[model samples]
Target: MQTYNAPLRDMRFVLHELHGLDALTSLPYFADLNAETVDLVLEEASRIATEVLLPLNASGDAEGCIVENGVVRTPKGFREAYDVFRDGGWNALAGDPDYGGQGLPESVNKLVEEMICAANLSFGLYPGLTHGAVMALSAYGSSELKDLYLPKMIDGIWSGAMCLTESQCGTDLGLLRTRAVPQEDGSYLLTGSKIFISAGEHDLTENIIHLVLARLPDAPPGIKGISLFLAPKFLPKPDGSVGPRNGILCTGLEHKMGLKASATCQISFDDAQAWLVGAPHKGMQSMFVMMNEERLGVGIQGLGVASAAYQSAVSYAKDRLQGRSLSGTKRPDLAADPIIVHPDVRRMLMTMRTTAEGCRAVGIWVAQAVDLSKHANTEGERKEAADFVALMTPVVKALFTDLGFEAASLGVQVYGGHGYIREHGVEQYVRDARIAMLYEGTNGIQALDLVGRKMPAHMGRYLRRLFHPISNFIEAHRKHEAVAGMVEQLERAFGALQLATGQIAQAGLKDPEEAGAAATDYLRLLGLVAMGYMFVRSAVIASERLAGNTDEPEFYRAKLASARFFIDRTLPQATALFLAIKSGKASMMALEEAAF
Candidate 1:
């Protein structure tokens, strides 16, 4: 059987020990928050995740969602689970205070999100998309629109969905054929079809607000002409009550490989009543606000499943009797030693454990930057924070999800043949984790964005946000005795990253294909270095704690062990990536197009 306990101890290590809550509470927006309050919030969220969501995960996947007579019904127990999630104010944890929210920091909220995703990823999609929509609307929607929609959406009375992909276009929005016509009442009529829309239509909420992208009749061709619009399943009256059904309809539901309980719909809009969001033809700009947030959330989805998978794998390793340990029959009381006694099994478990811990540290670091980006006191401080967030966004999304998939696969390996079947539930993690790499703009796109866009933006201002700190850390700790060895490893990886960045910059100027070819490997290199940096920092803290008397010595010792494993085993990948990146696009693009 699969089991997950929210890893609250590790979470506390990340929040209170590793990253420090003071970094956030010092900000005016999060001034009222303290360690005790945050702990309470996390404890409550853990209860809901373990109690309400976990039991329904496999059952939901088994039953999936159904579309009947144009109505979509979620799997059994989902509706009630969603109610428990919403009624407890989980939906409003990180929402805008002006719009009926608790106004918590993203740093805290993201940890809560990880627990929810771990317990039930499919269920997380419902409110996850809503939070993204809320962000876009809050950032770009007009005041009148905000007054009418933000409250109910934040309150979880109504859900939200993003409608960007048409059947014709997925990554390339320029190919979209969705059309919007202006009406005399300042509303637009949207007519088109969208596929792969998560939580697009579901019985969990009374209404679903869609943030859609469409082109005006006179709009210029391609992506530049695209505009975002707000369309709802049910239009609202002046009294904030549901009024009438809009033109939007659920055409079909996708038969996906995983996340079966999350409604992935094919939607049709026949002259859907909608209001414009942001300025005309600036849809991508407004929608990116939501897209970026979703990207981060999707990354968490990967971490969530990986964390759950790792826990299950560890449990199986300890209990399942396998070949005797090569060193000795450690478990002679049993017929065979527990698999965990074997070095090979230890390797897999260590890899999974290190990946989860490393990703969690990086996630929290970026999450802190997110809060600072919006609420810092000085413009300079905010700009720096925003730059850090922008640079690390792709890294977090790509690295977490990629490692997440690997961790899930390793879980299966730990379970051996039993994992391949659905009986043990590890296979479901592998299937579910596969989608995180493909969706939210796919891991490949994330790499390209990191290398092509973020690396070159504003003469590399965004790059400085990450590069400078790593550089500073290397110089500061190169000779420190406590963590000198770990710092050396980080420095080598950081050196490789620096060289790769420069090579991509200089080479791509001559041939963009060079950058494109190097993008994925370069992203991984950078991501590994970022994780190394976190691990080294963690090692420093753990070292200090262990040098003195501590209440929980094991936790700090384990932290140091994971950090060492990441540096020793994982960070070396950065060197291989650098070499691959230096090889350039010659061989990559050399093959003839018709060869296949």
Candidate 2:
């Protein structure tokens, strides 16, 4: 197994320099936080991630989970690792302070999650799901429900699962068949099956909390009839302790292509005891609490896996002896030079590194936005922050995962045959990353949401929240010689994004299918431009650091190089995406139903 190390320097740079962690201390909620405290927390998180979680990754993947007598048993070491994780208070790092949580900012949690995911994605899933459940219950559940469940879940003694998917329905929840009948005791009896449930049934926790979606008997048809329910594998007693087993059962675990150690279960609720969460017939809204959280978390999964892949690729490239440098022998003493000496290999490595760093920049930026949305002092500040969150969430989800898959593939390409083999682990990254683009509402769905809903939300308010900053930045710094090149490149890409946005919106106004056909390309356009925006920001900061005669000249210089590569090589892709969107829907719709 390849050992994992958290990118502490880069992470620190992002938090303290790029996002201005010190500025957050002004917020009342974060008044106690300082740079040193954040650093210590990050170092501790890195230690646990690299030491406790990474060692179990390969073994867990190889061994996987198994079911015996209807009980799902995780691979060896998972249970113990999870115990350590829970005991460390890692589960409550960002939970509500009122419910035994540390009450930290989401940005800190987001960064920590990236480390956890990079170390062991499967192990991270258990806590990841629990966090999502905690969010849902905290936001929408009744007071009694929160009191009964939040403590254990926040404490990590009990894990959580979001039960949404059914075999017949994946993204279309309106067609779901799950039903709930109201009981005289005020609790509902849930009857349904949920498929592809991550951390659904595991031995790592004392209890499993399931946030299920079901429909009431007298409810109207379609999505309006659906309701969210809080159901546990074991019903809680009057004293809030685990009681007899409820009507919930894990029917089976799916044999997946990757992350095999994470139990993706087929769960059945046969007249299970459940309490309604949120208002009736508003399950979708209730579930969005978890869905949105998971969407961002899933994007981090992409980053984590890709980071692992990139590290492996870099390691292999530096050590593996292969072709000589095109110019001449890089190492005369050796038969052939390391692959890192090759220009093409350098290009791939630069692409992987730039993508990871670029995505991290935007991901953390959005995370800060999340923090502001929830805790900003003024309503106006909160609204502006929320607008950015609304506009960029989909972009973050789709773009990061899409680029993540590409980076993972590049890792395999860098390694040649060795990467494809099981022993190398890069192949597992590719396999694991494949699902990220598919789940959490899929990349396509994210794109559609971006173009169809987010763009026009509140009359383009969200888009303006994002676009105004880039425009102001470009206008403010376009004349500066140090960052003129990056500013120019970013300006052009931003223009292309603006043009594509208007064109796609107009086309969609005429024919909705035009929007659907163009959604993916439009999203790609936005993503590239967004990354370009961050790269420009990074270039400006790097230039400032260089001008200040920073101690780490090499690090700042490398940041500039990465920004240049992204602006010169990657940002131009937005123009291509813009052209694709301009092509409209005729060609895409020409194919007949029988063509396939």
Q: Pick the candidate with the highest lDDT.
A: 1
- Give stretches of model 1 more than 4 Å off: none
Error of 1 at 422 (Å): 0.8
> Over the stretch 107-148, how does candidate 2's per-residue lDDT look in tens digits?
889989999988888888899989989998999999999998
What lDDT does candidate 1 reach at residue 253? 95
TM-scores, one per candidate: 0.99, 0.99
For candidate 2, the TM-score is 0.99
Error of 2 at 145 (Å): 1.0
Each model's lDDT comes to 0.93, 0.90
Badly placed stretches (over 4 Å) of model 2 are: 1-3
lDDT of 1 by residue, 165-251 (tens): 987799999999999999999999999999999999999988999999999999999989999999999999889999899999998
Q: With candidate 1 superimposed using the best TM-score fit, by how many Å does residue 386's alpha carbon deviate from the native? A: 0.8
